[model samples]
Target chain A: MSVPVCVLGLGLIGGSLMRAARAAGRSVYGYNRSGGPVAAAQADGYDVSSDLGAVLSRAQAEGALLVVAVPMPAVNTVLQAIATTARDCPLTDVVSVKGPVADLVRDHGLDGRYVGGHPMAGTAESGWAAGFAELFRGATWVVSADEGRDPVVWAEVARLALDCGAAVVPAESQEHDDAAARISHLPHLFAETLALSGVRGGNLTLALAAGSFRDGTRVAGTSPALVDAMCEANAAALLRVLDEALETLAAARTALAAGSTSELTESGFAAHQKYLERGGRPSITGIVPGDHEWLARLRDAGRRGEALLTLPREVS
Target chain B: MSVPVCVLGLGLIGGSLMRAARAAGRSVYGYNRSGGPVAAAQADGYDVSSDLGAVLSRAQAEGALLVVAVPMPAVNTVLQAIATTARDCPLTDVVSVKGPVADLVRDHGLDGRYVGGHPMAGTAESGWAAGFAELFRGATWVVSADEGRDPVVWAEVARLALDCGAAVVPAESQEHDDAAARISHLPHLFAETLALSGVRGGNLTLALAAGSFRDGTRVAGTSPALVDAMCEANAAALLRVLDEALETLAAARTALAAGSTSELTESGFAAHQKYLERGGRPSITGIVPGDHEWLARLRDAGRRGEALLTLPREVS
Candidate 1:
């Protein structure tokens, strides 16, 4: 028989997991603090309830795996609850940031049965109503296991991610946080900073707000509270990455202000090289060498820095 | 009879203009330096050609309104060609930025016949191959005209933007540049900067790079040269906005570093208010004083920022 699954906090992530689990022929139980998401999940033909104890009891009885999908601050409280009442079941989480959540699990002494998981998939929409079975399709899901986590549990989590059509990438909690700081969190702050500036600039920007502005600000429109939580939870890492971005901006600013194309080109070349190296594994610093033609282009770009290199018209 | 429209360049913007004009039952002529686009467009049943002289003679014979949709560097050359060849025709341009292009037209003494128009719509894709009749649908197209521009020419240009499925917004050349700097050009720079950082931080950021990374970097993958040209052309305005963005980011950073939730919350609340005010007119500044409930929440947020404000669980 397929392993039973219990999903805690039946909002978007939890509700979707419940559906995907049931669709994969696994017995699933769900718990929520609020009645609405539980009701919506139930209405969608899943077994869910607002009764946390009942859900935990079901998971313990079935020896199922539990998926914690709650916000950051609430994560520790949920872990404590799981530790006290559902220690028999293995556990994984779906928080955006991993280090803090992983640390919480460690502090609660649930590391043995717990693995940290973050499915990098979401729409601008949220909640149970927004949950879809294929929401994780073709997306990357990061799974981080602390030292000595059960391999069986890790395999089960990887299986779930794959079953939901997501690519599973293994990582450590701090590694996950650092990576997300550069790629996800930093972009949010950058966009938020820009959007705020646009607002402060008044009518002119609003009038001219176009596709680029809308696209750039997409993540900024996420719940400010959530953003605050994320920044606060991952403060140190995010700030470090934010500093790097600021430094880059400063370099560009100095170059622009001084009419120094050479300085600007160094910055631009650094950026152009990285852009060409996308989808490869990212390092802490410097462009990764991949694709010979791409590297040659980077070399050429470096050689031609700031001289106003126009591409042949055929490119456009 | 409706105005005769001649679109120079015959690229995506120019081709789209021809298709949109034809769909609106207006006579359209297309001129391109490249034989390929001109031949392809002509074969596709457009009134297209490679002979600049023939295009000029035809427009002169029929008294056409000229819309130059060439790149920034090429705009002056196109304008000069039109001045010496199709001098009688009323001219407008669809370049992205205005001040430099406007200055060139002014210096060349083509201001009376030249109205600076930026039909604020484009896709990641380019060229005649990317042309679409609906490219400008529901878009805001700014017509940057000055006291030096003729009223008749300005009205006709407004009609053209409207006929292309865009709302016509009027502004001075400098105002257009400043606003585009804040909204369009600067955002591109920010996206590129962030995207490059992610790319450079490759191996370290691999597991962390997810949907947010992909979404934020979407514009970075756009033609770097086009973006660079945009930055170069609108350097002064972009530089100003970049400075403002730096200040905004510094305030946030200072708040974060200083451990001041009050300052962070204030900035965040202000950002929220601006988001709500986005897509409105260009005159309103300083959060409009209404919506007591929303204001109260923001004020409360300022006083006590919630670390985790999920959408009410019931909504999910």
Candidate 2:
């Protein structure tokens, strides 16, 4: 029989992972710190255990893969337990940030058996109730494993991502952190900043805000606790990107102050117009080109029906 | 019989006004500087003319109301011609910027019969082909008439807006400019800045830019000439709003650099969350409260049916 996959935390990411794995016909198990998620998972016909020792012992005996999908703050405690109990089980994580998680695994001397994974997919909603089997489908899942690490462990982690209907993108931890900081973290900060500015104008400004403003600040409506964790976890990388963004904004301000519309409107508008004409898809080196090929392999491996394996439509 | 409406310039705004007025069963005539838009407007069943004198003479004979729906740079030229030809014709403009148009009217000694108007609606698309009868439906159209201006003239201008299915918002020229700068122009500047930044990151950043980034920077895709004209026309007010935005962004940068996630994430998220919870509508003081009543009156006055007068759904 294929090795079972055990998910920890049972929150949005963990619960979704369990569902996705099961949908791929993999034997899946789940564990949650709270009884509520465990009971809910059980109700959903998922095999979940509240006892950590019982879950870990079964995982070790069956040589199952373990996925730690806990929040950034709770990752350390889970890591400590994993290092002591399931030392030989291949493991991965589904966290937003990778550097810190990689460091934790190294600290526990479990780096050889661990890989840092992050699925760039989620809605503003959270918790088990918000989880869905197709959350990771057609998403870009970043796998940050050390260059010299065991290829088998990396492959196993990639297999999990593929089973969830994702395209696996391999990168160093630092690279992943930097890119995430630029595209994801910094946008959240800007969204918050813009939203706060709109609020300062009282209700009239909000009333006048059209599609552009709404789209620009939609992420600002995300839960504060989650925002805090993500921003804080990737603080250094986020700060770097924010510095670049401030420079761009400052140049626009300078042009505005000087009544130089050419800078902000001429060159800026042309560049953006070009970007849009290209369908807004950025070309990533090495990875994006192989996306279709990798997806085909993944579909063949999972044996998911054609409907489940089709590429997702590009979000406009 | 109601006074016929003559539209100057057969671009998107002018063409749309002609179509919308016609849909309300108002007699309308359109004029264009070029053959292309005039032909296109004619093909769309609009009564359009290429000869300025013919259109102006017909309007004068009919005691028609004149709407200058030209670009910012072309507004003065149209005003000069109107002063020479249809000096006594009740005139208004559909320009994005009101202050300059108001000044032009005052310079031409036509303020007595002129009101500055702006419609807070548009898509990224432009030109005659982009014009539609429903373009102004449910949009906030600012009527910037001088205080103590002729009530009859103001009523005529309000009638046009109501006929087009828009809610009339009364404000001084400066107030409209300031609010437009804060809510509309400033967001475009920010969108352009962010889009330019994403371009600098190469194609990978664009590829990874998900829904939030796309929504945030959508306006950056607007035509450069249009963007340049809008920014240049309202440079003063836009500069002021840009200063405020820079300050807010700088605060976020400082917080990020200082590892103070609370400022950027906690308060920012809460404020945004509150804004969303309130349905993203900002409360405007004078015009918003009586929207329903004004709309009803407008429909009755225009003789448009209830189906045509239905309020537009608020864009979330």
Interface RMSD for candidate 2 relative to the native interface:
6.7
What TM-score describes the B chain of model 2?
0.84
What's the lDDT for residue B81 in model 1? 81
TM-score of each: 0.74, 0.86
Clashing pairs in 1: A203-B282, A281-B202, A281-B203, A282-B202, A282-B203, A282-B204, A283-B201, A283-B202, A283-B203, A283-B204
Cα lDDT tens digits, model 1, B1-316, are: 6679999997788889899988888899888998999888888899888888889888878889998888888887887887788887888888888889888987877776777788878887888978989987767777664555665676677678767777666667777788788777777778777776775565546434666666666666666677777778888988888888888788888777765334444464567457666443332112212222332332232222111112222211
The alpha-carbon deviation from the true structure for residue B97 of candidate 2, after best TM-score superposition, in angstroms, is 1.8
Per-candidate clashes, comma-separated:
10, 5
- The superposed Cα distance between candidate 1 and the true structure at residue A197, in angstroms, equals 3.8
Model 2, stretches more than 4 Å misplaced? Answer: A266-316, B273-316
**DockQ values of all predictions:** 0.19, 0.32
lDDT (0 to 1) per candidate: 0.71, 0.74
Q: Give the range of the ten consecutive residues with the poorest summed lDDT in model 1 chain B.
A: B302-311
